[model samples]
Target: MSKARLLLATERRAIVGLAGLYATRMLGLFMVLPVLALNADHLAGATPLLVGLALGIYGLTQAVLQIPFGMLSDRVGRKPIIAAGLGLFLIGSVVAAQADTIAMMIAGRSLQGSGAVAAAIMALLADQTREQVRTAAMATIGLSIGVAFAVAMVLGPLISSHFGLAGVFYFTAMLAVLGLVVLWKLVPPAPRRRGHRDVGIDRGQLKSIIGRTDLWRMDASIFSLHLVLMAIFTAVPFRLVEAGIAEPRHGLVYLGVMGLSFVAMVPLVIVAEKRRKMKLMCLGAIGTITLSLLGLGVAGSGLVALVGWLFAFFTAFNLLEATLPSMISKLAPAGAKGTAMGVYSTSQFLGAFLGGVLGGFLSQQFGLSAVFLGVALLAAGWFVLMLGMTAPKHLSSEVVVLSDEHQGDALETLMARFADVAGVEDVMVVPEERTAYLKVDRSRLDTEALSRLTGVRD
Candidate 1:
């Protein structure tokens, strides 16, 4: 099995186009983060609580609609649902741009979030690529998101400074339009697929997925991570302004912090993956976030101190963001990955919603410092929870197509053989699906022999 064979030209096109589409959508959502807090006072009826609601209202809608949108995609085709989602996002952006009141702004943000196409896009990506190369394709999407976040953090303030918050909203609307165009023209059509757990949700497996302690831990980690992220943004801009950094210059701070943090993140990721120190690295990242938040709480009006703490915060954030999804994939059951991810995504959005609301209320009542202290407390709680988590195994799920001839007793024999294969930790053969789900260590697995046994090319 060569790399060229794994990723065909169509697969490459799907990967690049879909990654771009995902990044574009994410940019629209995140571009307001850096400037929203600064501009909130301008909107009519803008109390801290209302401002917080405007910032996080999108997550509430997203959390509510995400699974439903995914289920809808399964019924009416992925493209239609995705196109419709983008349309909803565009409409929301327009509404937000026209909003004069905080309530209207919240409505618009909620509409923007109503376009929940993440699961649909991922399922489409799975349909476009082969299993052997699917992980790489997914990784490309993840990379796109990280890049978009970094770019958005810098661009948000600059755009708002020049054209105002309404202008930023208009820009976001345009991005949504661009996403629709990309979906229609650039992304290839998803081929019909069956029994792919990586692609869509399985209702039957919900109980099992939710019941796993490891999965719950991962879910909680994501929830905590995003909660702190939204909460921090809710207050960080005010601190920057207080520290004498003008709103327009906020991008400079983000550029500096994000650039350095990314540089630091790469080596940590390499060590985590190559050295198999995932749990150690995860704990370290969590600890860093806790300390960074504490520093921000006490740093006061010092620009230098703020920058230093922000640098640490983002470095840890990038590492944790990158590692958590991988951890979920590794920890998920072979045939229930989609269900696990769906739940994980829901938790993440819910956290964003709660974080914004809570941060805003705290800041309003106790001041900006209180918001920082509150988030620090949350991060510390996350750190404590993570301490008891089991270290994730370094394994990849492999699907082997089973022939019709392997039935009943013969299938049982095949399953035994698969389990006996080197580096194969578990094997389950589903006769109804005519596929064998295998958990294997790629580092030690004999791919060639496995391919021979399953009559499939690796």
Candidate 2:
């Protein structure tokens, strides 16, 4: 195999490992979805509010710890941090499994939540792959999440019915153990690298990035993406059960709906990427989600609601899933991809927490209609916000790997090269990072010619 092909294979394996790890982690959380309220009441001192807290505390801790853990991975190494996080998760699962009261369960779940693996995963992927292929790597991980979520929704009730909620915890604990095994046996050892320089926020630079009205448009779009997602899921599972689909079969509906949605999403993704119409695709997804929410809010039949809402939900969900990260990569300050993602992820999780807590409270305080209405409002807002955002121009990158002695003129060389490359439209070179990033029009540049020009053989 060529070097690029070999690297691609390695990236694929790493992504597969990530899928397993993420699926295991997510399954533990999603297993509670079908039975949370019904099952929680049997435990000692359980209350609706406490149940909501338990449901959301994972996101809270996950949000808080992600960047810290990611930054820590820069020091302690990815494997060690990942192994440790999984161990913590296992411990928490065991604690929750054996808990005698709601308070203990919450504590155990909180501990489980503290095992934030996402940042470490991203950092590891970065270490292994070139920037050109990093997005593909990320997409693999994203697919894993989508599949894991589908599997969990289906299996949750079955596991709960057969082994009870504690059994679900036990299963999660076991999955963590399996993840540790994969980390040791399957994953390639990470190469040693210099620690990341602390990119202390520059007030002027920060203001430029954030103050750009266009960047805010993308940020708002992402925030709104997660908000609608959380708000809708707040009631979708319960709505499924109400439709006479029993707990065990909940996954079937999820699997079917998500399966179809995934299939449907592919064509659109192709058109967007190939035709270079990402902005249009993004807006279409938002509109679809809004209509789905409205349909669910008013549908008289369960089948109608289920089919309509799922179609709408997954259509938008998958599109945003793909688009948001791409936009961020294109939009962020060149060297601070990690920092930008940290902020984006934190916002995403915060939205999830607020959606669940607020959605639950609204459902309890008012009714199902009220829950849908809240979601519809959020989706509508997202749709309006997305209108102002522009599509990313292209997908290719201009990468410069600096030599030790050539550091002095690295930025100048990069700027000159950026101007020389036929398709290069913009450039950002960080001397501190010894990296030069370029955003270019792929169609305008013959990639083979450029690679030869740059001596970067594929």
Candidate 3:
């Protein structure tokens, strides 16, 4: 029978505390988005292009450093690495708060991005929970990020209206300190920490992971998604101003748009997952993004038009953001999920950096409307590429620890047996790790057969 395992008290604490820490850090990062372009005029040496650089400079550093930090945690320990990352974030926030020049702002933001502890944090969560409970823990963290983003969008403009840009940086600094407290005081220490194939990048898997065309398409999807996101923010604040919405009232506008978009997104997400229409939904969302951007380009100067397109843009954006991660999970090989995600994350950040650069360049060279049309063209191309991708089968991973008796030929025979079981898509057994990694179709998986096979003896 399929067994259900509940979380222990410590596990619950670990999940909640870690999710809070993740949310706090993200809140600090995203709060700068809506207000940075609006307030750039106050800084010496600010220009559209430079302002864009300041907007996305952190992504460059984050993309370069996140994987290494996660790998470092394997040697020194997760907590220390997390602490060090948060400290860097604290320092960056302080530097940014004092900045009077765009250059200084860029430097500070880069420091903020240098605190790339996502991989380490996930690894820590993996260590703290049992295999059965880890998925729930990860889901909590993901949900925390989404909530943080929604809150950040609303809070950023309000904070900026009251205390200006410096206050936003100061608030982020406070968030960093709060994250540190949560890390040490709230999250329970793991019994042990080690590299997890399912959760941490496996260097050996990179060649194969990157070699697959479908995975490449998935990576490109994230790249385009984030690129468009960063680029849109570079111009949206200006559009809001043109629409006669004062900077202070921008938060209310965002609050309304975000709330409506989130509500609109839920039913679409249900249709995508429950009805097995992810690919169709993904394509439709991308097409909607294209139409939204074009609509904004054509009519964004007017308030009603701007708000309407903003609603459309965010609805599509949220759907794509949620869908891509689930698709990545479904497409990844049994044991290479961590490596696949690592590459996917790096692509995401790089796209952010490029988005800022290119979006600003386009706006400076042509006009604000050009930025919208240009990104729309990019989305169109993305749609065409996706049309050819093979539909991904719904798949999930599971790990089953093996005993000494299941070694050599016995192990090979058991792996073969696992493949013969219904709904088992793929299986990779690492004798050294004494674990079997399975890619399964849960709707069709035979629970009794899997249980019997996993519990087999000589």
Candidate 4:
């Protein structure tokens, strides 16, 4: 096999390892959902508002820390940051497990949220995989998250029933220990930051990316995505119980619907990617979400709400979850994928935090109807924002390793030459890593031309 092929295989293994690590963390957070309200009162001083604050604090910390942590990973290396984050997560889990008071539980959960690793994982994936295949690698990780989420929701009740919420924390701690092993045994060694070229984003790049109206729209779409997601969960479980399924059985309902929705998302994603119809898919998801929430706002029967609203919400949620990353991947300047994801992830966590807080407040003040109505409005706004977005033409980015000699003036000269290549949209020359990050139009760019100009073969 070729060297590039070997490297790709190695990267794929690393991605799988990382996927397991991600699943472990999410399982800890997700398994609490089925019974948070039921058991929270036992912790003392628990109210709906307090429960909401506890749930939302994780997102709040994650939103604040993910970008800096990700950028830090770029500088210090991926594994160290990942290990440190996982350690913090383990400590938080243990703290929560032993908490007798809601205040302590909230504090533990906040620290757990502070163990933000999404950015580091993404950066690692980017570092290991070439640009041409990075999206596919990313998609693998996304699949893991969705599957873990579904499985956790379904099993939350069963797990809690067997071991209690504290038991869940104990399990999470055990998994964190295993994660440390996986990090060492399975994760590939950090690709030497070549000094050939650096992929790190600076203040100027952030300013440029944020200034683009199109990018802003994409950010808004992500924020809206998570906001709607958290809002649905805020009310959906209660709606399920009101419909007749009891608290413990809600997990079964989530499991069933998510299973079917997971299957459905596959073909829809294939159609969107193959057809290059991201805008259409995005609009369709928003519309579906709006209609679903509207139905929930008006529906009188639990069954009617479940069939009309819950189904619509999950279907749309799964589809949007799959497409949003792809759209961001397409829209971001090729060399700036890390920066794009940093902003995207920050918005996502902020949305989750806001969703939980607002949903709680709305439900407390105006009833569930008001919460659904708010979600409907939010979805409507997303649909409008999406409507105004120009359809993104499909493209891919690649990371090319270069020799250390290609630094300074020589790298700039190479960058100038590479920029003039037909179909190249953006190029970042990193002298530190000896890598050139290239974003290109596949149809317009000549691959052979790139290979010849760069003196490298993929």
Candidate 5:
């Protein structure tokens, strides 16, 4: 039971390259969020409802296309689907950049989302990396998203202040081009194209995966998290301005809060992983977000209090953002990881869309404080959901190709043999797929012994 370097050089390159690719694109999308509501009035027909629509329209398209894109990648190659998605994103940025009306902006945002590449990207990452280190690789991508959001929050206002709204879209288009370059030059090709149920969507197993109450809980958590996030930003910038922070100086506040929250997030993540207290940490983070939103509802009138609550909000947001995907990877059924992730990603984008619409409507009809209180209720509901989730086991999923001779009665014998191996917890042998999925305690599992018994080379 010794720890060894899990990622090879190729694996390391793929992880970093894909993480950068994800971050670059996400930065483009998020750059408009912080300042858009503030500056949207300049565009033609830019009512509050239209402004919110522009902010959230991307998510609707993204949610619609996420699963199809992943399934397409399974048949076509990963790189091709990803490249096409980026092309759509690039075109959307250009359209949005040139738009004069809010309706046009929404159209561009929808096109931007038509390039739903998240599932394809994750599936490709799973394809290129080994099972043992896959969770860490996924974590790297998740952290990239969190960092991108933080950077975008600050950079959005600064960039928009300098270049105006159209300029921000132009810059976003440039990012899409850069992302294409990374995908082409940096990301390594998958070693071989084979079915990876753990990292890919399986149509046949979709029902089972979605029916799991635990997976539902995780999906709901992400939906709630992003919902609160989008809704808050809908009104937070205006609140900041009313409290005396000018639009141009909004970046400073974001920079400060993000920096401090990131510092706080790292330690909590470490403690959760090392102590195997994921459920506890998850619930606590949700509680923290709820408290932050409650504080915003009550105390957001003051500049200092607004910043204080934001700091707490982002700290919890960052922690949960990094934790949920890893938890999904761990808890998903062996052969349905991709389908599970596809659903998860869809829930996330849908939440973004709903949050924007709801937040804008509330702010327009009720007031800014009403938006905060509404999101606080969402956070509280998520906290209740988290309370019922079972703690995930510290285990990893592995797949082994079965030899032709190991069929029929031999397959049953093989399953029984692997079950006898120490630290092996669950085994499912699918003769049609000619593969075996195993959940094992990696720290104690003997890979060499299992390989010998299964006649599957590592």
Candidate 6:
């Protein structure tokens, strides 16, 4: 196999810092998912509906604000927005720690979501790394999130069991503090402070991005995926307890299941990407999720059976989570990647909010099996939508920083020139930003031509 491209030393440092900052913040948010439903019963005004709301309240705020924040980062400095967001997250954590009611918990979680620094952080990462390595950097960040999620599932129950729910909130507050420190101390300064179309939301591209049917389907996929996730947790924790696992010992189950699921998922992911079977794999995973949910509802009375179904659910969930972003990257138009991702992310958060409310409502009214049944039906809907999706082409993005020499060129002229470049399938030139974005098939890329384009910058 050809050796992978290596990151520059500086790029390495920046990625580590940014990944750490992102992971710590996400860790703080996720550490409550698995334990909250079980522990929140003691809070005043607690109800299944309210608990679910508190569990997913962050997604509502996050969905509403991330795009705005990314756009704002173009005007103000990236660090300021990031720091301010972290401060809000810190305050929210403290508020939750002191809350005596589910209402307060909801308030705190909403505040936590309001931080919405994801876009700003991506912009910063783009500023720090060259285009060749930016995708890898983004992948690293994605991996960190997955890792944080898995760890949180295990840790949340353990901490809540030993120290109470307030302890988890307090721990998140400390994590926010640590995130702030990493942001400033470890993450390197961005070399340029400007809008990046590939990594930052572009207002001009929003309408176009939203109009693409394929992109919308990708967005819907994420929304369904996360909605099911948040909804499942609202009831699953209780089921584990009912199966005789103590609330405190819930982490052990998560650890075992998550570990095995990950191990089983790796080869499948490799097959999906390497063999060009993304569509087949995605469909299979969704089918697995539907079947697993059905199995859980029908025959999960025994602990062993319950664990088996849970493992299957998570394996499919993990695969979908890994593949969806990649599909977005492949299907999204070149220059509008940031805008496409912004819309996709908004859909994801909205799904989380709805999932929590709907899941809790079903569990409260009908029982735990009802929650699984409801989500299963929703997953079936997702599968149908996905079945109509055209297979995504294998493509990647290239960003070119325009030099002053291109200032006199017409936007159309520049775009035509870029489109004609060997292997480049699409091109977008924003003259105001003096940047060009291209979608290309790497195998067909003409290295000499690409070098000539970037080489023009002096």
What lDDT score belongs to each candidate, Candidate 1 first?
0.89, 0.71, 0.89, 0.76, 0.87, 0.88
Q: lDDT score, residue 345, model 6? A: 86
* lDDT for predicted candidate 1 compared with the true structure: 0.89
Tens digits of per-residue lDDT for model 4, 1-458: 44654546678778888888888888777666655655676788776666666667788999998878877886898899999999988998899888888899889888888999877877777677775566567778888888887887877767666777787777778878888899889888878642212234455578878877878888888888887777656566677767887666777777777877777777878878998888888888889889988999887556755765677778888898888877777778756766676677788888877877777677767877887898899889789877889888787766776654455557679789789989988888766656688878888998788877767675
Candidate 4 vs candidate 5, lDDT winner: 5
Which residue pairs does candidate 3 place in steric collision? none
RMSD in Å for model 6:
2.2
**Residue 198, candidate 3: C-alpha displacement in angstroms:** 1.4
Q: Which ten residues in a row have the lowest lDDT in candidate 1?
A: 403-412
* Candidate 1 backbone overlaps, count: 0
Identify the runs in model 6 with alpha carbons over 4 angstroms from their true place. Answer: 1-6, 403-409, 456-458
Q: Lowest summed-lDDT stretch of 10 residues in model 3?
A: 403-412
lDDT of 6 at 195: 70
lDDT of candidate 1 at residue 300, scale 0 to 100: 95
Candidate 5 Cα misplacement greater than 4 A, ranges: 1-9, 130-133, 189-192, 401-409, 430-434, 443-448, 454-458
lDDT (0-100) at residue 430 of candidate 1?
A: 77
Give the runs in model 4 whose Cα sits over 4 Å from its true position.
1-3, 6-12, 74-77, 126-133, 189-191, 194-201, 403-413, 431-433
Q: What is candidate 5's lDDT per residue for 156-239, written digit by digit as tens?
A: 999988999898999999999999999989999766666777767778988898899999899999999888888888899998
Query: Could you tell me the lDDT of residue 202 within candidate 4?
Result: 54
lDDT of 1 by residue, 1-458 (tens): 56535678889899999999999999999999888888977788998877887888888999999899988887888899899999999999999999999989999999999999998889889888877788788899999999999999999999999999999999999999899888989888777845467657888888999999999999999999988899888899999999999999999999999999999999999998889999999999999999999999999999999999999999999999999998988898776777899999999999889888988888889999999899899899999999999899998877777755566547678888888789888777777877788888998998777877776652
Q: Write the per-residue lDDT of candidate 6 for residues 1-458, one digit (tens) a residue.
A: 21225677888988999898898899999999998888887889999999999999999999999888877777888898999899999999999988999999999999999999998888999888877678889999999999999999988988898889999999999999898888888888767686777787777888888899999988888999899999988889888878999988899999999999999999989988888799999999999999998887775558999999999999999999898898888888878888898899899999999989988898889999999998999999999988998988888888877777778988888888778779999988888877888899988998678667656422
Model 2 — which ten-residue stretch has the worst lDDT?
A: 195-204
List, residue by residue over 1-458, the lDDT tens digit for candidate 2.
Answer: 44653556666677677667777787776676655654676779876556666666677788888777877887788889999889889998899888878888888878887998787877776676666566566767777777776677677777877888888889889888999988877777786644321121222354566666666676666666665655555567667777887766766777777788878888888888787788899888888888887888776457766676877788778877877777776666545544556667777777766666766676677777677777788778877877877667665544555545545664677577656877776677667766666666767866665565445676
TM-score of 4: 0.90
Alpha-carbon deviation at 223 in model 3, angstroms: 0.7
